[model samples]
Target: MGGTVVRQEILGGVAVLTLSNPPVNALGHGLRAAIDSALEAALANDSVRAVVLAAEGKVFVGGADISEFGTPPRAPLLPDVLDRLDGAGKPVVAAIYGAALGGGLELALACHARVVGPKAKLGLPEVKLGLIPGAGGTQRLPRLVGPESAFAMMLSGEPVDAKKAVAMGLADALETGDLVEAARTHALKLAEGGAPVRVRDRGERLDPATRAGFETKATEAVKKAPGQPNVAALADVVRAGFDLPFEEAVKTERTRFLALVDDPRSKALRYAFFAERETARVPGLSKETPRREIASAAVIGAGTMGGGIALCFANAGIPVTVIETEQEALDRGLARMRATYASSVKRGSLSEAAMEERLGRITGAVGLDNAAQADIVVEAAFEEMGIKETIFSALSRIAKPGAILATNTSYLDIDRIADATDRPGDVLGLHFFSPANVMRLVEVVRAARTAPDALATGNDLARRLGKLPVTVGVCFGFVGNRMLARRSAAGERLLLAGALPHEVDAAVTEFGFRMGPFAMSDLAGLDIGWRTRKATGGKAPVADALCEAGRLGQKTGKGFYLYPEGARTGSRDPEVEALIERTSAEHGITRRSFSPDEIVARLMLPMVNEGARILEEGIAARPGDIDTIWLNGYNWPAWRGGPMHWADSLGLAAVAADLDRFAEESGDETLRPAPLLARLAQEGKRFSDWGGR
Candidate 1:
C-alpha cells in the first residue's frame, strides 16, 4: 500500500489509483505490480463501485520504461496487468494527459472508458522503436476503431488528440475542462446507474462491411510501409478479432509482441531509442551550469541557412530578426521562405493563419544594429573567416550583454570565430543542417574558450526548436559533415574508378541510405562543389566539365545521370561518361571495375576511420554522438544503428584490417587506418566499446 502507486479515497463509491513514477511515469515493474494489487483491492471493496486511474504528474504514462527494454521486463508485464484490469467488473476510467503511447495506450484501451482532456495526446508509438502493439492493443483497438485507423496509428506512430480520438470512437467520451474532475464524474455516473462498458463488446463498429473495408485499407497501407514483417504482423493480429475470440486474439498479440522484441531491427531501433536519450547526457558537465534564457533570437544573414534559422525561431514562437546586407538578396531569401511556407500550406500542415502568425514573428532588416536587442545571435553568413570575424567583432560590440553568439558554420574554425569576439566565452557554433527549419539535427560546436553557460544555452535552444543537439569540439568539420568529408571523398574516387553513378548510388541505397551518394550529389547540384573547389584553390576537372555541359543536377535536367526533362528519374548519359574518361586519362588514373561490396567498403571505411580519429581527438565526446549525428542529420539508416553501430557490427578490428589493405593498394595517406582504429582493431573492441570511459 505504501509503494509508489497510492490508493487514495475520494467521493462516495469512487477510489483513485495514482501511478506516481517520476519523469514519464513509465509503467515499470513497481508501477505494474502496484496497479495489479490496487485493482484487486478496488474490485474486493463492495463500497468501491467504480475506480479512476490517474498519474500524479504531467503525463498518464509515456511508454514502457525504455530503460527496461533490452533487459528482462519487471513483474506483471503491462499486458497481463492490463488483462486483470479489463476483467474488473467495477468500471475503470483512465484520466489521460500528456503522451499516452505504446503500452500506455494499450493500458488505456483495456479500461472501460477513457477521459482525455483537450491538451492530452494519445498514441501507440512502438513502430518507431521497431515494435508493434503487443498487449491486446492490436486486438482491442481494431475492434473499437477498426483496422484501417489502427494500422495508420501503428505504422506512422503519429499521436492523436482527444477530439480525434472521440471522433474515431477510440475514446468513449472526451473530457472537458479539468481532466481529473471529468474522469471522476464519468466514473460516478457509471457507478450510479450506467450499463457496463467493455472494449471487447464494441461490435457495432467491427461489423462485416466495416471489417472488410479495414482489411482492404490495411493491405494497401502495409505495402507502402518500408518494412513488411511488423506491419504485416499487426494486420494479422487485427484480423484475429474476426477469426478468433477476444481472449485468443490477445494471446496471439502477446506471442507476436515477444517475437518482435527478439528481432534484430527491433533491437537496433530500441538501441537508437535509448541512444537518443543518452545523447543529452555528457559526463563532465555539471547540471548546475547556468543556461541563458533565450527569449528572442536573430539570424545575421538572409541566405537559405539564415532564413531557415529565422523560421526555426519563429516556429518556437521566438521572435527573430533576420539581417541582410542588400535588399535584393534579402527579398530572394524571404521569397524562398515564402515558397517553403506555401508548400507547407499546400500539404495541409500549416493553416493560413498559423503561417501568418509565424511570418509575423520574423522581422527582416538590412542592419546588424537590430541584432543588438536579441538574446541569441546566429551568424549564417558566407563561410569565410574574414567576413565571419568582421561580423563577430561588430556583433561583440553591439549585441546585448550575456547574449550567446553562435555560428551556423557547417565546417569552420569555431575557435577562430570565437577569437573574433571580445566575449569568446559567449561564442559557440550551432551547425544546423541545411534547410534548418526541416532538419532535426543541430551540431553544437564547443570552442575551448566557450563558456559552460553558452554550451548549455545552445543545447537548450536546440531542444526548444525540436532538434537533437550533439555537442562537438572545434575542427575542420565538427562531427557530421567533417567525417562526411571522408565519405564524400571516398564516393568521388569510387565514381572515378570505373564504377558508374548508379552502381555507387545503388550500393548505398541497398545498404539503406535513403539516396545513393551521387544521386544526393546531383540533387545538391554539381555547382556547390565547384564553389568549394574555387574557395580551396583547385580545379576538379571532371566536375568542372560536367558543369560546363549544362549538367548541374536534377534541377538542370542532368548532372551525374540524365533526368527526363522535369522528371526525377535517372538515365545513362554518354556525355558524362566521356567527361569521366577524359578526366581519368588526364590524371593518368586508369579506370577499373568495382563490386558493390567494394563500393560500400570504400565509402564507409573512411567514416569509421574518421570516427575513430574523432573519438581519440575528442572532437566528438563519444562514439554514440557521431552515430547520433549520422542517424539524425545524414539519413544513416536507423535499423543499422547509424555508422558507428554498423562499425561495431562489422568489427572494428576487421574494419581496421580493411583500411590497412586499402591504404596499401591505393597508396593514399588518408587511406591509412587511423591509430585509434588500429588500436581498437588490435584490442578486438568496437568504437562503442571504446567510448568516453
Candidate 2:
C-alpha cells in the first residue's frame, strides 16, 4: 500500500511528477493527497516553469480506486486534485499510457493538454457504472470536444485509442517514444507560448448549432437506455452545463454524481461490474492449478450452434474443424459460416481479408473421426442423451489420450455422457448459448468425475474465446437454462391464469428485458420447446397446441404472436388470445386480469426462488455465478444486475414475503421461497453475504 506514491523530479526547469501506483494507478485518497502535495511543491518552486504529470508503469491511471468506494470521504478528493490541475498557474500536461479512464481521463481533461502513448486509451466511462463524470469531465469534455463526441464517449463508456483521441481533440498529440519527455517538452512549449489553453475556456464545440445536438441526444438517451438513469443524468448535466459557468456546472455534475451513487439502478450496475470480475475466479481452486492447453479445436456438428462454436475458435485465432456426418451437411455449415462473416464484411465491421482469414481457420469435414487430432473437441450435436452418449463413445475412442471432450448440451445429464467416455475425467459440459459466437456466457459444467485441469481448461478456453465462463456443478440445464425453465413455467401459468401473451411480454419488456417469454418463443420457434415438453412428458398446453396447429413461429408466420411476412418483431394474434382463454376454461380455471406489475412479479420471482435453490443445492457456488450466467446468457438486463441481485436490491425479506404470497395465491409449491432465501431474508442479509458458504 505504501508503494503507491507520486514521484517528482525537476528536469531543466520542468517539473515531472510521475505517478507510481503499479497495476492500474487508481487515484485513491492517499494517491490524490500525494498528487496534491507534489503539485503544490512543483507550483511553489520558481525554477519549475511547467509540470508534466506522468506515470512510471504502463497505465496512466485506470480510474478512481474502487476499493475506496462506499467509504467515508477523504481529504484531497479526486475532484479537488483535478481542480488544482485545472487552475494550475503553470502549464500541466498529462502523459498517458495504457488507459486513462473515468477519473483518470477526467484528470487528463482537467490538464491543459494531453500527450498520449501510441497504445493509450482515454475516456470518461463513468456512465457505465451508472454515474456521470463527477470530476468536471461532463463540463470540460463537452467544452473541449463537441457535444456529440462527448455524448458518444460518456454515454457509451467506450475508450478511444490515442489516434482517435487526437482526432477528437480529447488528446493534443501522440507520443510513440518517451511519453514523459514528450509530455514535458509539450508542457514547456505551452509555457513558452504563455498561459496554456484550459478545457473549460474552450467553447468552440458549445455553439448554439452544436448544442442543438445535445437535445437530440438527450431525447435518444431515454429511449436507448430506459431503466438506467445515468444516461439521462449525463444528458441533463451536459445540456444544463452548456448554459452555466464552468465551475458551477462542475459543481452541479458532482451533485448529480453523488445522487446517482445511491440510485438503485446505479447500485445494480456497480454490483454487476464487480460480479463480472468475481465470476472469472474459481473458488476452492488454486490459480496455479495446471490447465490443459487448448491449441486446436473441433466441433462434432455443423449446425447453427456447431458452426457458431467453430467461429468462436476461428475468431480467437484458433484453427478449428467443424465436422458433420454427411458431405451436404458439412457444406451447408461452411456456407453458413461464410455468410455470417460475409454479413460482417458487408456491414464494413470486418475487412474482406480478415473475414477470409477467419474463414480459413475453419475447415469442414464429413466425419467424427476428423476431430481426432484436435486438442479439444466439443460435441455440439442434438440435445439427446443417446446422441451425446454415442458421440462421447466415439470421441473416447477417436480422440487422442488426455484430449478435452466437451459436450455443448444446454440441458442434459452430463454425467451420463461422461460415463460413455473411457476417461470420464476428460468430459465436461461447455454450454454455449444460441448464436454462440455472439453471446458472452459459457457454462463450464463440472461433472462429478471431471478432472480439475479439465475444468480449468474449460474456463481457459472460454476466456480465450472472449466468453464469460461460470463453473457450475452438473444439474439439469446447469445455471442459466435451469433458472430460465422456472420463468417459462411461470409464464405458462400466467397464460392459463388469464394473462394475454402480449400483456405478459409488455410487463417484462417494461421491466427492462429485451424480449418477453412469448415473443422469445416465437423467434426461437415454438416447436423447439413443444418438442422438449413432449420428450419430457411435461405440459405447456398453449405452446404445444400452437405447434400442433402448425403455428411453428416466424417460419410458419404464427405462434403465440403473429410475425407477418417474416418480420422479426411479432404482433398480437387474436387466435392465440382466444386459445389462451379456452385453455383457462378447459382447466376449470376462472380467468382473472393480471396487471403489468403482477405479471412481472409472477414471471421474475419464481426464477429468483429457483436461483436460491440452485445456490443451496451447490449447483452454483455463489449467487454471482448464477447472476453472471443470467446476465450474459439469458437476456437478463444488466441494469437489474440479475434475478438474484435484483431480489437483494428489492430487500430479501420483501422478496421472501412476496414469494410466499405468490405461492399461496397460485397454489404452486415451486413459487415458495427456497429455505436458503427464507433464512437470509429472515436474517436481513443479502446474497452477497452468503459468500463461499
lDDT agreement of model 2 with the native? 0.88
How many residue pairs clash in model 2? Answer: 0
Q: Residue 310 in candidate 1 has what lDDT?
A: 91
Q: Give TM-scores for every candidate, taking all chains together and pairing residue i with residue i.
A: 0.91, 0.95
List per-candidate RMSD values in Å.
Answer: 3.1, 2.2
Report residue 47 deviation for candidate 1 (angstroms): 4.2
Worst 10 residues of 1 by lDDT: 1-10
Candidate 2 regions exceeding 4 Å error are 1-4, 208-221
Local error of candidate 1 at residue 149 (angstroms): 3.5
Predicted structure 1: lDDT: 0.83
